[model samples]
Target: METITTFGPLTPAAEIAAAFPSSVQGKNIIVTGVSPNSLGLATADAFACQSPANLIVTGRSYDKVEASITSLRSKYPNIQYHALIMDLASQSSVRDAAAKINQDDKIPTIDILVNNAGVMAIPALTLSEDGIETTFATNHLGHFLFTNLILPKIIKAAQRSSTPTRIINVTSFGHQFSPVRFSDINFSKRAADLPTAERPDLEKTEFFTGSSHAEDTYYGFFSYAQSKTANILFSVALNQRLWAQYGIASFAVHPGAVGTNINRHATPSEIEQALKRAAELGFDAASKTPEQGANSSVLAAVDPGLSLVDVAADEVTGVYIADCRVDDANVARFATNGHLAEKLWSLSEGLVQQKFE
Candidate 1:
């Protein structure tokens, strides 16, 4: 089991970025889902500035991928940044992406793998080609498969590098919604948490395609929350496996409620109301730019100070960290019960089947 301390309410991302250390300057790092833009893109951009040996940024849209390459090149003309197109929701696309990375001659290994790409709150019961729910497929399963396929390379890099390699998963605090439903993940036999009318307004927005037909169609929010929880569980299980053997650790981060393309999936009315609420709360989503939202991720992945933690004497493995601190309450169950994490991982592994090794 892993044990970690909770560091809540981190300084704003912008404030942190101003004085942030550039630790990934010579490392080989990969940040996926950087095309559409958001905190993830900002995070990728931040890493580019560090001048890594190879910065592989990926996204689904070819045009967006091209645009990201163009933008990054203009800003950091000398950095070696490569952009690839891949659909994480599809197992085939993820496999092909990993295969291409494995075959690359430019670099022998990857020092950091930031699983920063994700979707949010779409009110539809969509399915991947493999027939799994879209949210579950992209947000959790895709990263799960991606990480394992590249584990050997990551391990090798850690062995050769000065600092240990790490995995920083970009997730949301909304994971508090519900525990992972080990018995039925697809919600095939269960009712959704939010009602149709109460769900985010998808009718007025043309954001990403949802998993169901309507807000109440199945409970997109509930599904989203559940998938995020699964993400935390995955982190717990992943850290448990890697910490002892590889000296590699994992972390989960919530980008602190920034307004991004995620609203593209919500109804226009919902978007308006959300923005209005943000205004009323004096909570500036703009306060933490994507670059800043990605600060903790940057710190977690490459910061040397973070390496001083006593991994051998203390059981800090597989703990959820937000805003640059440990969050055990957020993951107490998995920390205390390896069986539950193993159970969930086994169930998900079975569902993904051939997609995994």
Candidate 2:
């Protein structure tokens, strides 16, 4: 199927990886959330094939990180692979990981940072030790803190190289399902499960988060949507800031529907309903393999075309990309909300209890 952006039928990850031997070769890249059989793993795999100078695979478990390193070493025995343990679920873990990475003399700079780690559709309303909601903390706040901490390294790398630095935040097209729950993001009163009649107007039915899922139920879908929205807004705001101040390029990518660990949380009945809906939509395949799924992100990471945006007026360009091309953000107002982005940025700083400034 052709993408809405009109540029591709979706290039597979291998072809995309092989296409940019020059750009990716010898570049120091960090890919987060790379466990076995996952999106980040596939992405890191493709990147390793491109002969990166160093590939940093970061995840929650030391065993997982070691497993990824061992797996990648079998394929690219020569390229350097470093394992860094950083759990996105814990603020202290994130802080400790960042501090270690910064102090490491060997990892002096990073050319590309792919924020692909995320927690999705968690069935329960879990929170981090810092008391922030689970999905929001893992999907948004963890990346938020990690990025700010490593941003100096990315900047250092950009300063030395003539090329622009890149930060790719992997978001989801499902962002339309919900926006930031400004008043009660922590679910103090079960914001997602509030009485339908009393629920906020935006959640009731907006281009994003509005659905036929019943007016009085919580599906945990909207929680994921809200976090994805945070990803999009964060990209826009980050690009705008970094471009204005440092000239680095940042992007948000929707790595099409791909089969991965995220589906594990769904109940059998829920999965059945999803498959039924996908079948109803003209028998379209609801999911793709990790290679196919990693296209947009790999493209975002190496595509020379994305560099053109930085040349336009200011670094104020952050577009939602999918299937290897720039696509609409589905018109979710919050994606373009600078005020809300700034507010979320500030709120995130407090939640993680850290300030980049």
Candidate with maximal lDDT: 2
TM-score of each: 0.80, 0.87
Give the Cα-based TM-score of candidate 1 against the true structure. 0.80
lDDT tens per residue, model 1, 111-138: 8888888887777778889888888889
Worst 10 residues of 1 by lDDT: 203-212
Q: Write the per-residue lDDT of candidate 2 for residues 1-357, one digit (tens) a residue.
A: 122223343466767867766658888999999989899999999899989898999998899889988999999999988888988978889989999889988888898899999877778777788888888889998999999988999988878766547888999876766677766676565444655422333433332223444443444666777788889878876876787667677778888668798778766665556556546554344677887888788777776656433323322334677777776534366665667678788888888777766
lDDT of every model, 2 decimals: 0.67, 0.75
Lowest lDDT 10-residue stretch of candidate 2: 1-10
lDDT of 1 at 54: 88
